[model samples]
Target chain A: METPLIRLVNVHKRFGNKTVLRGISLDIMEGKTTAIIGKSGEGKSVLLKHIIGLMQPNGGEILYREKPIKEMSREETRVFRNKMSYMFQGCALFDSLNIFENIALPLKEGTQLSPSEIKKMVGERLRQLDLEGTENQYPSQISGGMMKRVAMARALVTNPELVLFDEPTTGLDPIRKNAVHSMIASYQKELGFTALVVSHEIPDIFHIAQNIIMLDEGQIVFSGSSEEIQTCETPVVRQFLRGEAGSMFID
Target chain B: MTMHESPTQGSGILHSLGAIVLYRIQLAGHFTLFLAAGFYHIFSWPIQIRKILQQVYFIGAKSLLVIFLTALFTGMVLGLQGYYSLVSFGSEAFLGSAVALTLIRELGPVLTAIMVAARAGSAMTAEIGILRISEQVDALKTMNIHPVRYLFSPRLAAAIISIPLLASVFNVVGIIGGYLTGSKLLGVNPGVYFLRVESSILLSDVTGGLLKSLVFSIVVATVCCYQGYFTHRRKNSFGSKSVGLSTTSAVVQSSVLILITDYILTSILL
Candidate 1:
């Protein structure tokens, strides 16, 4: 069997008295899109954060390319970070930078590309994202959908090996959601990079994700293909699928 | 039961007081650690010259006008007050010496630092706090950039480089303002006024004031940056209100620390 590109071994995370992730163990295959779906406050974003070494697990270890992130040296960690990119839920574009400058930042800071070379790459990424003629605009000037596209362009500008997305389609209209979903699908196909997306959009995200993992109250309740999820008779899963508050409501 | 309840009330008061003390001590410890981390990165190779220059422009050049105006008015008031008091003793010729000595030793550095703490330091706190709230700082970290190296060190380094220069400018402008008031306005004779100032002011006094300004700038920058960087870590609810509170606390803490540091330096230097 091929070794997984990333592995989480019994990962656990807690904030204060609240336990966020309770012993999560999973394997992320190479060059595949995995979607994590959960109700609000279920640690899906926290789990994604652990994969990128942004937040450390309280217990257990994360392996990037089969090497433990904890054991990586500073130079190794820097290289690991360069190979991965994270798109924040709120876009997290630098307020001080324009769209072009925002997209150009990682390339300018992380790579040895010349100014013209950087410009060429950034321009190409912009065109790919359908963001032409919006270079000088600040993030606030653009609509939410455009901001998400700009963020996506920035995350992909470096052509990283793994992209971690935190709710990329949240708060977007269905049209914008479709645009983002298609954008992610096209980019994953063309770039051939592994993607881990944390999203709440149900049936829509199912189309893009090859594998789905459902988290509830910090534990993995289900992990399988989308078809398996559809046929699964789990009560929590059924309630979540129907978008209803089941008998498990807590006051 | 009543005796037990009385003991419980007494312990509750003690516990509350102890918690407050512990909280303050923890905050101080965190601030010291933050300052140490910033200093550690200061000597790292590949210095960000562009960022340093940008901070210097923001902290120094931008503060020039306010410092100039403040010094001018302060000197004029000092000259007016000193001339009148000295005239009572027939020692009005010492007006320039009083003005120059007061400014060089105490007023210039203290007032300039307070102004900077109010203006530039508050701005640094607000900007960084906003960045923290908006997750830009996290974004920087995920991009493999050290937030302290990219943010705090530059501002700290710039403030250290600029504060002394600003204080010197304040001194110069203040002396001119005093001269205009005492010599040109009050007819104390420019020669005697300048002579008294030159004779009374020592090199050590000027150097000491500049040293105080340097320390004050570091305090302001460190406090402001620490507050901003740890906005999310604060116990309060995380939002714009928290950022506002951090900004206010930064200014208050920096200004208070400046005054306290001034006292300690004065005690040691004098």
Candidate 2:
């Protein structure tokens, strides 16, 4: 009924001769968790990257709040970037920094918050992620699942309006994977931030994700809500849900 | 094994040669702009004094022991060699001038730069390369922080400030070491040696050495940081192996550039 929070139209991306995203078009609604489930190397991460301006599209356009991202001015771009955050697959925390400092970095660099205020905000995120006592510990000192939580904390530290998660729970055990999903769901609810997740967690992710977008060879074969995905008889969608699209179960 | 030449071989070879020259020029242009941006950012508002101080500690303070030892040993050797050479010429009284002139005019800055290329420069390449490989640089960009300003400019500023000071220290310690070897070990008169050292070193020589150190520092910082910053673009793909190669290339290229630059500057300064 209203304009989408972000929109991608006929986006094309290629690395060398390999066209990763072949005219991809999608819409991400506001304040909703949208999961992009696709086979490995299907340009899911590349798609997320294009949305965040990490990589520009070879063709077409990405619009944020009805404004074409590339057409925005320098100050406008800064404002746009400030309103979003990305959680890398590897949990790309600053290794040299301790957890507290890692979480505080965005707030310290991006905002004019005082030292005490930054400490308070970081402490709050740390508590939300159950990273309470690990503030002084470095990323290497923490567990893989905990590192994901720390990354989540850092991403949420800036109170962004849009957060991109790339395989947020891929390497974690099932319990931890669900935990990360639940954490994202809860954070999305509490913060009401639009989320775009490039993940393969399948049904587990579907439980938390309201909308589902399926990619097959970088082309969106299915786009609808979780219920629509389950009932859709499209061959590609069925093959993907049946774990035949070079990935695990999703239906 | 030589392959048979095709009809277009001559033209193809010329085309490739032209491409290589163009590529090299492009690279030089990129490097100039990168270094210029780093230098320009050093003057931006909210001067990153704290980060610069940290870099100075890493680049300068940590280098004290090695620079001291190298300067001392190098000076001692110069003293021994000069004394022996001048003794046969019956001019051993000029050993102070020989050691001071060599260290102040040439060896001091060259050796200090080479040492730093080994220590701080290589380490910088590896550190920044790892960050690039780990996506921390991308993270910084997404956070709206300029990676060049955050990672590179401070190191450049620190290297610019540190290398000259370290070279000066190298000269001082080297002169003292020469005194120790010539006056204390050999039979040269301490008074004559000191007097020669004071008189032989012209103001131009000292300034020239300082200038060389500054240029060498810029070369070392630019080459190494640029290598690390572009580690992902290596033909082999982005990985720890690429980072390793970038570090090695940075060290080798910086060392070669330093020696070549030294020769050019020496011709002009002399």
- The best candidate by DockQ is 2
lDDT tens readout by residue for model 2, A1-251: 87899999999999999999989988899999999998888899999888888899999999998899999999999999999999999989999999999999988777878999999999999889999999999999999999999999999999999999999997899899888988999989999999999888778878988999999887999999999999999987888788873334453
**Compared with the true structure, what per-residue lDDT tens digits does model 2 show for residues B66-108?**
9999999999999899999999999999999999999998999
| lDDT leader | 2
User: Each model: TM-score of chain B?
Assistant: 0.96, 0.96
Q: Model 1 segments beyond 4 Å from truth?
A: A248-251, B1-18
Quality class of the docking in candidate 2, CAPRI style: medium
| Model 2 regions more than 4 Å off | A245-251, B1-7
Worst 10 residues of 2 chain B by lDDT: B1-10
Write the residue-wise lDDT of candidate 1 on A1-251 in tens digits: 98988999999998999999999999998999999998999999899888877798899989987899999999999999998999999999999999999999888767779999999999999999999999999999999999999989989999999999999998899999998999998999999999999988888889999999999989999999888998889999999998998766774
Candidate 1 chain A, poorest ten consecutive residues by summed lDDT: A242-251
Q: How does candidate 1 fare on TM-score?
A: 0.96
